[model samples]
Target: MIVIPTRLKSTRFENKILCDIFGVPMFIATANVAKKVDDVLIAVDDEKVLKIANDYGFKAVMTKTTHESGTDRINEAVSKMGLKDSEVIINLQADEPFFEGLNLTKFKEFAMEQILNQDAFMASAYKYIEKSEADNPNLVKVVVDENSTALYFSRSKIPFDREPYNDYKGHIGIYAYSVKTLMEFCDFSQSKLEKTEKLEQLRALSNGKKISMLKMESKSIGIDTKEDLEKALKVFKKVNND
Candidate 1:
């Protein structure tokens, strides 16, 4: 199941999810696009968001307003829905409307393949980072071993080099895992690295949960700040015209 965990109190762009994109609410646009591949649900924190979601003709679930992270909200939604242990859950951000979802189709295959050989239960994707974005803390960086197993995820530039850096991978904000593993990860305490970097994925990595990383090409336009939203609007117009 594809789930979007959204809330109203956005730090950078207040109520960004409700902002219009392509003539509709950003979250609704995201869900409508995702529905082309499969059914989608929105886990929201407030009645306003829930009402908006339902008005958009999408399934909505109300979660605790006190949740620390979106993942925690997703975990609670999964439990509330009573999903099967083997059911796959994808957390696609409500603000990302252009994510190339074809890549996600392979997550189950890759995860199962890794499970047979390693301890991988969670999976995510990354893309090559631009030179300018390499030093940007807003874009998370990831370094992986030869096997494509994530070595670390950080807000700072990773794999610091003495010479000119050659390659950098920016972490995407989407994740895929079974309902069971999703809950397990939520129960784990925030790790030291997680606290320092403020990245929840580190909590799973710190607790010995293997996260398999997939290389992806297509990406979504993320709306974080007003400038980003403006860029997204232009992109939306271009996409619509195309």
Candidate 2:
């Protein structure tokens, strides 16, 4: 099951989820993409969001607004859904209106492969960062181990190129987890590095969870502000034309 965690309050943009890009609310766009998967639900914290989900004829559940992060809200939703411990759960971000269906299908395929190997506790997507994005702190960078496991995630550029570094990968917000692992993550408290870096995935890494990252060729524009929304609108129109 894929769970989209959405909140009405956004520090960067007021009522970001409610903001329309191409005549539909941002979260609705996200939900529309996610509904293509086998099972999808919007885990919302506000009545307004729930109403919006129902209006769109999508499955949704109201959760407590006190969740500290999207992962927390997803965990609560999973419990309410009575998912089995072995069920797979994908965490899709509500702001990602531009996520393509092919990319999502690839993500699910990668996750199923990892589950068959019985080594990955969680999985997420990453793509090679363009040189232009290296300086943008909003584009989080990651350092990976030889096995393609994440070593660290930071808002700052990693592996400081003392020697003209030309390559790095940017972390995407999507995540997939086994139901058992998701419950375990909820039981554990946030780690120190997670708090300092303000990156929630660090908590899983610090706790010794192995997260496999699938390299994707496609990239989606995340809507965080009015400027980003405009850019996404343009992309949406272009895709619609195509």
Best by lDDT: 2
C-alpha lDDT (0 to 100) for residue 172 of candidate 2: 85
Q: Candidate 2, TM-score vs. the true structure? A: 0.95
Each candidate structure's TM-score, on Cα atoms with residue i matched to residue i, is: 0.93, 0.95
Per-residue lDDT of model 1, residues 1-242, tens digit only: 88999988988788999888768888888898678766788999999989989888899999998887789999998898987887878888888876765755565456556544445778887889886787988788999989788989998888787878868999988888888888899999888898898888999999988888888886466777888889878886788799
How far residue 152's Cα lies from its native spot in candidate 1, in Å, is 0.7
lDDT of 2 by residue, 169-201 (tens): 998888988888888888889999888877789
Q: Worst ten-residue run, lDDT, model 2?
A: 110-119
Q: Which regions of candidate 2 are displaced past 4 Å?
A: none
- Note the Cα lDDT for every prediction shown: 0.83, 0.86
lDDT of 2 at 235: 76
Top of the candidates by TM-score: 2
Residue pair clashes in candidate 1: none
